[model samples]
Target: MNITKTDVLWNYAATFFKISSSVLLLPIILHKLPSEDVGIWSVFSSIAALVFLIDFGFNSSFSRNVTYVFSGVNSLLTNGHDTSAQSGGVNYSLLKGLLSSMRWFYSRVSLTLFLLLLTLGTFYISRLLNEYHGNKTNVYIAWGLFIAINTYNLYTLYYDALLEGKGLIRVSKQITILGHLAYLLVSTVAIYLGFGLIALVLAQLISIIIIRTISQRKFFNADIIYQLQNCEGDDKKDVLKAIYPNAVKYGITSLGGFMIQKSSIFIGSLYLSLSAIASFGITKQMMDITVSIANIAVATFLPQIANLRIGGNYDRIKAICIRGVVIANLIFITGAATIIFLGTPILHLIKSNTNLNQQVLLVVAFSSLIGLNSGISGAIISTKNHIPFVKPSILSGVATILLLIVFFKFTNLGLLGMAMAPGLIDLCYQGWKWPLVVIKELNIKFSDFKMVIMKTDKPA
Candidate 1:
């Protein structure tokens, strides 16, 4: 499962298509939906992000463990992995247990999520709709579809972990590209046909179906199916127990992450006008795009890093980290620069009512630079099956929220306050601490980092 150059290119292509579809879809969305509808959509998007919180980090834990199983590790561990126990052969018994555990876990979780969204989510959306001046019927219709799609997507989420854990980067990314294409084409046609918000949700439903179906076929090819069928019995409970500790930690960290990145919109909706939320949402969306593109290098190598970790290949991991960090920074800088310089004019060109606030965008760009690198560093640390930054991440999110409350209560900063709060909090801790920890852990020197920046190539 060595990562090939083609794999790298497809990874980039996948991200490109995913982001570009969103970018290309924006003008259409802006034209079709009013600013109020756009603002509502932003809330919907933020709420949808709660799936990450609901997942409680099981996806990453599952994916990392899947990598371990495929890497020939004989047993699972609650904390740290056992590199020395490698058997140099695939453990189909372990794989089968994990697959069973994943299905059992997601089935229950997905049902719970569906119920949560239906009750708590509907209550929240009802509040938003009560103040709405648009057609509430359309929004309600869209909301139902949103719940259905998210629940279905979460149920089939393991396909992603399965593909990436197998180091099928190229295949996984190809599926993403196809999914995004389906979303783009369907949404465009549906919107043009006057479907409005329902169009967006319907398109997403179609895309998720395509992605999951393709991923199932690709990962469960005849050879794998046969192997799995013939494997000895395994204890799903044991596998889950081994995964629970780190999975819980990762869940807490994700909660912190959600608070830091998304709480702003939710809070802003209470304090600011709908137009303000729309502006901030658009800027945040662009920054998210930049971050995702920046993350390509590191994201592509995650399973490989996990495999190398089992083999005690620190030097190789260091090289990937250095190169990944460097590439990520470069992409973020370029993308942020593009958004800062041209984002507003482009909005105007699209005749978009929701304009990006340049001041907020600039601040967010700087903060995002810190955030993306910290994420890369965090990923590096997680390969060793530990998550020490859980406390720091959670603390940062808390501090950011408190500061946001203070700023909004007594200051005139408005959207700038929303942008500045998380940046300042993260800069104090997560922004710098994680990278330093990675450098120390990997024994990376300033000179080595600089050298990697100058000559970024795959390590031997």
Candidate 2:
């Protein structure tokens, strides 16, 4: 159950390369596009986030299943060598063959579902555009862009999952770096040619498609394809069925989470100015970047943790959970401090004329705080398969919407207050609820959880 330092470095490098490339492009995008165009882009992104909900958490669920199968195969080989003289026993071969077949069948079914959902989503978006935007050509263009980007994203997930299964994270990192470079090159060219926002979308899609194709060739190869094609029947059902619950949990959580995150923009468009939405959107993007980094610690550990649990290394799993929480907090505190002190300067760099309400800063700061705090508990809950807590997460979204209404209606606190309310609610929920869940449901000692916050261990 030992994790090499090289593994951690490879994982971090991958995440950092991806984040850096996107960060580098942000300024170019903002500088070239108008504020209104940025707002429109935000709306498009918000809609795409909703499409993620339809993913039904298949990405994570599939990764978990893939990891389990790979780990199980390794375990069988080890046992076979130890007990059966290095040649696998009949039962070992049977299990290996069964798992291989099962993975193939599940992969086909997953691909089918992915395509079906994408079609349904396109139809839904088309209908929504008709009712809301009313035949605007840009809406159609936006929808096309959405489909292309999401299709590439779907394939990227496939390649990424395969890499995780093979534990070829260094290769994954290289693919990510190449993809980002492609995106930047395409976007720069598109901007130079006056291609507008569509250029940005196309750049992203093309880059992802290229990376996915290359990575698939490099890692998955012919033997994997042969195994998948030959797979069939009840074995496949078992793996798919095992993953279904987690997928549904993540899918529903994504739906509610997306609604909460996007409700403010929706409300702003209806009741506030487009400029206000633009300002808020910019701030949200900053927060998202920070959250994504904080999330890396948790994400890097998930496959390993799942493998550990499958291997019955519960003590190691518990230690990992504690370390993850502590690392998340450290990231959160540092990020929050930077935002509190430097938020205005950062915004000024992006748009010199951009004047933000002080309240907006507070809201953003508070929300970032809540986000960081909740990240610890959320990671544990997801990795441990304690998915019932997702109901509370859904409620957090509902609370965000209701609070926005009340804050805007009854308080004269303006946009900042409206924004800050969601953060406050999230903080309270994590502070109050996470403890009970960890102690009562997870059965981890409260003292151990507390020690995680106070201790400073490097994350595995």
Candidate 3:
């Protein structure tokens, strides 16, 4: 399969939709729902993210290994780069086995996620909602729908692995755009109809269904169908064994990363008022959107980066590092300033249920930028297939959570603590560490980085 220009273009399109859905959905949700209910919605979204821990990084790890199979590697490697000699053959049987492994894994995980979210997840939400005076019926209905959507999403997650592994990013992004449009349209209508929180999750259900169905049809073309049909035997266990080592590592790393990113929301809900959570969550969401917008190019090129690493193209990888950092810094710094200066006004214009203080958003901005830079470094390093920084990433999260607990409990910071915890810990290690590792790995000198920073290339 050949990569096309649209591969990158459609990725931007998909990001537009994702960010657009959030931006568009928010004004409506904040407008229609009560502040307390909005807080519950925030918690709901956070829990949805948490419940995905059940997938436990299988989808991403599977996708990366699937790329290896397609790259013509015969066996899964633990570390180091694959020699270029291994390229040029597509291992359809291995992919078939991987697909079988995916289905087998998802089946149990999906069931478990459903049961857990329906029980434990629901319990968590109920605890949050105990102080709510909003619409209980709608919240309950939305929770049920959220659970279902996640279950189905987990079950069919291989559609993503297949598309990404085959490097069909453009096609996948197009389908995603269509689904998100539907989500936006339906969700907007639902909110206008006063459906409240249920409206958001209901729209998501529709979008996921549309997106997954289209992906399944688009990916299983004639050649792939022929290969899968000819393929026999359930090699799920073999596939699991092949991917589990790094996959488990990635899971732990991801757990730490998720906690660092989300622990504020989770713990803040416990320590802060519902209204405070709403403000803090909304502010954090804005920061996330900024990072996502800044990250478009590098994120789209991840599979290609993997391919480059396997080919031992250190020069190209270094170039990507320079461009990614430059773009991320420029975008983040500009966006951060704009938001710091205008965020309150923008929130006001939309009649938002919550708003951000300049100081608070500023803390989040710089901290998030540092974390984003680390993320850029991590992305480049992981392309080399050895996760040397996994421990630091996990430790960073532990540190961030502990900081959050201490700040909220012992200080007068309150929502300010929620905003500062992740960023503060990130600055301590994650922000600077990963970039230094990348520099060391590539044998880059400090002067070269200085020149690279001073130089400007094409717009990322």
- Per-residue lDDT over 38-57 for candidate 3, one digit per residue giving the tens place of the 0 to 100 score: 78877877877776677877
Off by over 4 Å in 3: 1-5, 81-87, 445-460
Model 3 lDDT on a 0 to 1 scale: 0.80
What is residue 125's positional error in candidate 1, in angstroms?
0.9
Alpha carbon lDDT at 257, candidate 3: 81
Order the candidate numbers by TM-score, best to worst.
1, 3, 2
Each prediction's whole-model lDDT (CA):
0.89, 0.62, 0.80
Kindly give the stretch of ten consecutive residues in candidate 3 with the minimal lDDT sum. 451-460
TM-score of 1: 0.97
**Could you give candidate 2's per-residue lDDT for residues 286-380 as a string of tens digits?**
67767777766666777777667555566666666666666766776787667667867765787633345666766776676566656556656
**lDDT pick, better of 2 and 3:** 3
Question: Which candidate achieves the best lDDT against the true structure?
Answer: 1
Clashing pairs in model 2, backbone N/Cα/C closer than 3 A: none
Candidate 1 residue lDDT tens string, 153-264: 9999989999999998999999999999999999999999999899999999999999999999999999989999898747999999999889889889888888888899
